[model samples]
Target: GAGVSQTPSNKVTEKGKYVELRCDPISGHTALYWYRQSLGQGPEFLIYFQGTGAADDSGLPNDRFFAVRPEGSVSTLKIQRTERGDSAVYLCASSLIGHRGELFFGEGSRLTVL
Candidate 1:
């Protein structure tokens, strides 16, 4: 893809359900990130992947959230036991390895826990 791509632009589920969000980054980009944005706040970092491994996942709120970039090109965020408080827009961004500040972001997958 020429830019970052995310699937399921809008997802609404009852609380306690499991959800998965996908992100396909720009070709050749070596860094990918997951972020969550609540109603009016800025995107909050959830995880960062460098190639096939996650270099930082400390920002994830709890054990229920996890992410994987198996081949270093596409990533998926998995949420277990979703809660209403988890409703937010999940954003994905990618950039060249050395260019952390220049990220290309996807439109985001909005998850609404009902």
Candidate 2:
């Protein structure tokens, strides 16, 4: 892929349901990150993975949110016990290791929990 790719551009789920959003980054990029954006706010960092290990996950709101990068090229964000307040655009970005400034973003997967 020439750029980041996110699956299911829009997802609508009922409250208490579980959802998994996937991201496939550009080939060979090593750093991947997940962010969330609400109605009027900018993208908020959720997690970051360096290779197959999570380097930072402090931005995740709570235990219901989790993400994994198993092979270092693709990642999945899992949301458990979803709530109406969790509706937002989940953004995935990637860049070459040590080149955070060159980040590339995917068309976020918009999660609408009703």
Candidate 3:
């Protein structure tokens, strides 16, 4: 079984740009979550999807951030009008529901806004 993986482990972009971070979750897992972690801080929940629908997205900072899990598996985080404050590690995790699960995190997509 494959663990979650993220692309562009590092990304640098200017202010007011757009960026998309991809995440590949573990096979057969139906629960996917996205979290943003700043330096020396715990991961802040961004969005969580159970199956093909987003169960919780209140953690998304603003409209600039959005995510989707069309096939109930892989997901992507899209950020528009990127700002320096958006610089952080975007982590993706997946787990088995109701199984006393622990989220398995990806290396993370580190975004740098300059």
Question: Top lDDT: which candidate number?
Answer: 1
Off by over 4 Å in 3: 98-100
Candidate 1: Cα lDDT at 11: 99
Candidate 1 per-residue lDDT, tens place, 70-93, comes to 998999999999999999999999
Backbone clashes in model 3: 0
How much is the lDDT of residue 96 in candidate 1?
92
Ranking by TM-score: 1, 2, 3
Question: Which regions in candidate 2 have their CA more than 4 angstroms from the true location?
Answer: none
The true-versus-predicted C-alpha distance at residue 32 of model 1, in Å, is 0.2
Tens-place lDDT digits, model 3, residues 1-114: 468889979999999999999998999889999999999999999999999899989999999999999999889999999999999999999988812588888999999999
The whole-model C-alpha lDDT of candidate 3 against the native structure comes to 0.92
Name the candidate, 1 or 2, with the larger lDDT value.
1
Q: Scored by CA lDDT, what does every candidate get?
A: 0.94, 0.93, 0.92
Candidate 3 weakest lDDT stretch, 10 residues: 95-104
For model 3, state the Cα shift of residue 88 in Å. Answer: 0.3
lDDT of 2: 0.93
Which runs of model 1 end up more than 4 angstroms from their true locations? none
Q: For residue 100, what is the lDDT in candidate 3?
A: 58
